[model samples]
Target: MSFQWTFLATFLYCELIVVIILLLPFISPRIWQKFFNSRLAKAFAAGAKYYFNFIICVFGLLFLDSIRELRKYANIDSKDLSAPHAEAHARMKQFRSQRNFYIAGFALFLWFVIKRLINLLVACAREMSAAAEAHKQAEGATRHLEGVMAKDPTKIDPREIIASPNNPPRYVEAKEHEFEIKKYKQEISKAKEDIDTLRKEYEQSMKKYNELQDEHQKSQIQLAKLSDNESSKDK
Candidate 1:
């Protein structure tokens, strides 16, 4: 029981501070945003996370040691209770009560661990949500551009706006966009030409194969007749 008390006191007084540090990112995202972006802060967070894990491991070891101490103390206590001396028996009872109090301290450690896990999960969810939003925006922009490109290309000339001083910003931007659309259109045309060339080559190859197969079949039939005549002559 004394061992349990020692464990509780250690965790409450010392380990609790480290747990708060671990939870700071989740407790206040503003703090995370301010500090997490800096190189020093990132490095510190990495080091702190590592140190926190190390501290948890140490706590585990101490808990194990406490368990052993508790068992040993319990054995001594059982013997003391049986002793005729009331002084030692009262002392042992007090020690047992103290150790029992330490048993609840492990739950505190468990609470901290759970909080840390939730913080990590929250950070991951935030990043995934941001990424999803960015992808949605990009897809929307792409669809809008495709719609514009589907219209008549002759109407979207950048050169007409270039010589005019009163041209709007949109005209200049549209001109740049027109150049991109034209380049993409040319690429599409080239791709179509390549596809046609490949199709023609494939047809030509199939025709040649059929012609060769027909010639081979005719030669095989002629050979068979010559062999039959030679066999009859030999007989």
Candidate 2:
């Protein structure tokens, strides 16, 4: 081969390698996700991915080396395809075929990795959201329990106004009661704020409920009118 022919072949091979690398990411997204999600699979995929890259690099270097040899041969004697040259040519041709096969396989793997990863992420998000919602409901229930304890009539809950005529001012008990009263007052303020917020939410929900009821009534009236029209038509 001439120097120009050798250069053209090298350029074409490099282009082919680039195209294969670019396609791998899109084709193996799911495979990547699955592999990355588990520790064992992640390790395996990392090793495999690196090995694949290494093999591609080796092939690329070999291709370049072969092209350089071809250029050297062309420079020395353009027409000779003798023993050593023929052997080199055969190896280069074999490498090209093997490279194509590797490219196709890697592309499939890449696609699989990406798809699996996306699914895992969506599942994880849904689980996290459900957990958060449950926590919020539990916290609300706890706050309501605390408020009920603060206001129970029978239970001499230390948190409320426990004023009695006989226990006018025993200094120790008075101080303890003062502290409890202060704590309950703070809780009361917080509960009031919550009640205001809930009132607004209830009002909005009631407004929507009334709107739906009105819509239902309208729909009933329309249905009755249609029935009457049909009855008249029959008559």
Candidate 3:
């Protein structure tokens, strides 16, 4: 009976050690990786650590008590449970704990790295938007300046011509072209506004011309009637 109990206790202790060793790799990976990849995994892992630690302590205490009971009831050899082996196990546990501590530090480092990367992306987007806006504004200003130069090509800056000798003329025969464009635009606007006035004047002139023509026709008829009356009276 004592041998069976000792064997069972040894088996349980071995199982616990196997579980702890297997779990160390999972528990010590960067926290952010788990947080981003799977929240459920991260939670499970955290919970597992606590439960595993509790089980280890419980088993250690149980094994110590079991050894004491074996010594009293069965007279097992004391040489088998050496202090050096226990001390070595204690040191191994301490190493595993330190390794886990480093994992926490790695998690923090990864978090900062990801955060800075996001910030850089946002900043780049902002800079691109600003550059695009500035480019649009510059294009508009260039167009406006070109129009001004077209209107007075003869007054070009000699300094610009000298500095940019290789650059081709942007506005050849510009003064005439600019004047014609300006004149056409003005005529178009004036014609639209003067349409009503022109219509009114045309109607008035037509009325005057019709009245004169009618008066001339009536005088011709009156003269013909007078000539006819004189001929009849003479007869």
Candidate 4:
């Protein structure tokens, strides 16, 4: 094989190995997330698009060339086939062309597959991370609600204190004296509303977390199926 063709074959092998590694069940999404978020990975990702495009272009040209060679050999004149040496040479060229076609085609195809797999894994990782954060927030809200409930304002009434037998009744200034009592009631009502709102928020966060977990599971199942198929093909 020519150096270029050999290099393409080597690259195709590497791509296959990478796909298998990525699909391995042992590697968790969190590890993939950490790797993708690393500075080196980020730097590589910044230019990966352009590099992938260039590779696609190169492989595309090679694939086309292989097709052209295949067709050329297929259409060889009967006059050329009359000579055994010419016939053998044409057959050899056709075989090489076919081999190159498969190599280039698989390389290009695997590139796209690998890219998609990485995206799927990354999305799963991010969803799992978000779900965890939401769970934490929900727990915090629950704790806050517990603390607020523990300090129930209804246990201590300003009106009850003012109306106590030990205190002198101010009947003449009753209207003015009730002002503080009304303000406290309003404050207590507002606090209850705030607590309700917080409870609702916590519920919503938990719901979101559940949805993310479902999506993550689906992604994992899909990845497992894909890996299984690939492994079967290898076998």
lDDT of each: 0.66, 0.61, 0.57, 0.86
Q: TM-scores of all models?
A: 0.39, 0.30, 0.29, 0.58
Total clashes in model 2, counting residue pairs 3 or more apart in sequence or in different chains: 17
What is the TM-score (0 to 1) of candidate 4? 0.58
Candidate 3 ranges beyond 4 A from true positions: 1-82, 152-235
Worst 10-residue stretch by lDDT in candidate 1? 153-162
Q: Quick one: how many clashes does candidate 3 have?
A: 0
Per-residue lDDT tens digits of candidate 3, residues 95-138?
A: 54443333333333343444454345456556776888999777
Candidate closer to the true structure by TM-score (higher is better), 2 or 3: 2
Q: Write the per-residue lDDT of candidate 1 for residues 18-39, one digit (tens) a residue.
A: 5666566555554555555689
lDDT of 4 by residue, 1-235 (tens): 9998999999999999999999999999889989999999999999999998999999899889878877877666778788769888888888888898899899989999999999999999999999999997777666656555686544433332345578654344558759888899999999999999999999999999999999999999999999999999999
Instruction: Compute the lDDT for candidate 1.
Output: 0.66
Model 1: pairs clashing at backbone N, Cα or C within 3 Å: 1-99, 2-99, 4-102
lDDT, residue 208, candidate 2: 100
Lowest-lDDT window of 10 residues in candidate 2? 153-162
Which ranges in model 2 have alpha carbons more than 4 Å from their true place? 1-84, 152-235
Tens-digit lDDT track of model 2 for 1-235: 4453444456455655645653465555444345447889567666876765765565465556555554544333334446667757766655654554344344434444444555555575567668889997777666656666786434333333345797543234557488898999999999999999999999999999999999999999999999999999999
Model 4 root mean square deviation, Cα atoms: 34.4
